[model samples]
Target: MSETSALSATGATESRLVGVTAALATVCIWAGWLIATRYAMTSSFTAVDIGLMRFVVPFVLLAPIWIRKGIWPKGLSVTNGILMIVGSGAFYTLMVASALEFVPASHVGILLPGVMAVWAVLIAMLLFGERPGKVRIVGYAAVVVGVASLVALKPAGVISDDMLMGYGLVSAGAFMWACYTHAMRQSGLGALEAASFVGFWSFVVMAIIALFTGTTIGDAPMGDIMMLLTAQGLLAGCVAVITYGLAVRHIGSTGASAFGAMTPALTALGGVILLGEPGNLALVLAVVLVILGVMTASGVFRRARI
Candidate 1:
């Protein structure tokens, strides 16, 4: 091979390595966010408080970008922008945050992503005519089954009355997030642009709501508040999107997303350690199925076969 060709190959390899590392960091941030959000909801913060915190920090930090691009962002359609705001912003945050008041972090982490995979694929199929292979179909089916086992079956003694409600809310939130992901893709928005767009609108919407109804901002311990500020505001809101898109750019979307298959298990383990949330057989079963299903749905195995 020519020296130039060798250098190009090395560059591609390095890019992929960076993507893999970023994906891993994004996954950890996601898991840690769930755990921290759960702790905040159960102990100190209300859903509205979490929503404010989640968007406010990012919106302030990204003020310069949104100020220049505006909320609609020059080339993005109104429809996609609305979808992005409602799906990933205050609305989605409140749904998951309220649900966290009743359910474990494991449930939020697993159910949202598992259901989201199904919803996202279905949306793509309907809107873009994207056809999933046989493997993908089976993977989506597995995700549905796993979710059913957790939500519908709900082991006898392990559930509370509000648990079902929590599950339902989180599932709805997942649908919104699926819509957001698709809208972002359809708009061709850069990761930072997308985050700023969502954060700015969410801050405005939540602020308006706070004006009318007032907020549940809490007097939580400073240490806990600082934790949420970092986890919810900075890492999950700002950095995760950028890293995830970077991963997609280098490793391809399928390769980058397959790493998300690990999040359910990571959140479950974190719940056990940090929140003292008990892990049951059903949790284990759901986590395993969802991981395998998300990985398969992401086409990891299919790519290897090809």
Candidate 2:
């Protein structure tokens, strides 16, 4: 095994509080990123354009570290290398960016966390045999109902090809992310190394996609494009990616997955302040319900493991 794996094995039992805090930090960063991403997506910019920059910023930031580490982890098998960089990084980015094209940032905020939490619970139960208790199951139900209401109430003339596609894509991204988290744990790769590997390959795949699709430059408002690229590439890429990778390493896959539930609430709040998206009554109620459900599900309400 690699040194990263060995270190993980020795430190597995070090501290649960630390792990949980790390996961929480990741969620906060992601929530803030969601707001910025929504603002970045306008009639002027397409998802592909945003995605290209996501890869570019990270690749540039990691250039030195990558050079020093010699590009690619020593212990990463070829299959995992491809899966992490391509499957986890590039593919997920494609799904999310495309979805954001049609879906409201609020909808994304609600759905992203719901999908992630539910998937985490299911995957943990099936793959790792970890079962959430009764409270958590009920909490999961609240999340489902809350998300369903948002969809059911989607404005009547507003549903379009783009919106439907966006939802599907984002949901797929969530599922892929869940699988990636589990796979990383199973593979025993350390967080930093995994992040670096994913960054390298994501950059490669995105570049290929940009080339194939013919990257859209000077197509959107130059100012918006610049802002989007900087946020997605630097804040979301360098900071968020590195933080999340470290979080997943400290928290087990299941616990880390729980943090996703907060993304929607944070995003919704962001929408109100940043995007001028209305804070409807439904938004407030949904946020309350989701927050309570997440708390209950995380076993804070009861001593049961979720």
Candidate 3:
């Protein structure tokens, strides 16, 4: 091969490696966000408090950038800002936090990312006329079956009415996230631009809500509060968002999104280990199905010619 061709091959390989590494790290931090939020719920932190912390820390950290670039940024549209803020910002945060109040972290881990993959695919198909192969069809079916399996376990004294409500809320959050992802793809905002827009708007909106509701952080221990702030704001909110963007830029959105398949099992495991949440047959089965379904829907196996 020519020296230039060899150099190109090496660069492409390095980029893929970076994408895979970033994607995996993003998933791990996201899982930790779930676990930490669950812990916060049992403490003095309210859903509003947790939601506020998520944006406040990131917003403060990114303030200089806003000052330099201005709040709106040059390329990002108003619609992009609105969609991203509502989809992944305060709205999504509060939904997940409220759900944690009613259900285990394990449920959030499975339902949120699992349903998101399914929704992203369906949305693509509907809007773009993308045809699903046989493998993808089966994958979509598996996701449905996995979710239904969780619902089925409800009558066996496993899932409660409150849990069902939590599931509904989380699912809605996932749907909003799917919309956000789609909007971001078309928004022409770079990763930092999108993250900054989301952080700023989320902080403003949550602050307003907190003022109206008289929501305060209460007497939650400073250590616990700091943990929540760092995890939700810095790690999951900022770092994960940037890393996922890197993955998308490096390996394409399809490859980056396929990494979501690992999130369910990892989050479930984190819940069991960190939160002492019980792991059962149904949860395990759901995790397996979700991982398989997401992998299939994302075309991981198909691309491998498996």
| Best TM-score among the predictions, by candidate number | 1
In order of TM-score, best first, we have 1, 3, 2
Give the per-residue Cα lDDT of candidate 3 at 276.
87
Q: What tens digits encode model 3's per-residue C-alpha lDDT throughout 1-306?
A: 999999999999999999999999989998999999998886678889998889998798888777778877777777766778888999989988998988788878888987887788788989889888888889988988887777654546576778889888888888889889888888887777778878888899999999987665766677887898889999987898789988888988778778867888988999998898888788889999988898887788877784
Q: Give me the runs in candidate 3 sitting further than 4 Å from their true place.
A: 1-16, 125-128, 152-158
Deviation in Å, model 2, residue 166 alpha carbon: 2.4
How does residue 110 of candidate 1 score in lDDT?
A: 89
Per-residue lDDT of model 1, residues 1-306, tens digit only: 999999999999999899999889989999998998899888767787788888988899999999898867888998999999999999999899988988899888889899999989988999999999898999998898887777533556366779989988988999999999888888988889889999999998988877887765655677877788899999999989888888888888888778888899999999988889877888889898999899988889889789
- On the 0 to 100 scale, the lDDT of residue 11 in model 1 is 100
The most accurate candidate by lDDT is: 1
Residue 239 CA displacement from its true place in model 1, Å: 1.1
lDDT ranking, high to low: 1, 3, 2
Reference-based TM-score of each model: 0.93, 0.78, 0.90
What C-alpha lDDT values do all the predictions have?
0.88, 0.71, 0.85
What's the lDDT of the predicted structure labeled candidate 2? 0.71
lDDT of 1 at 12: 91
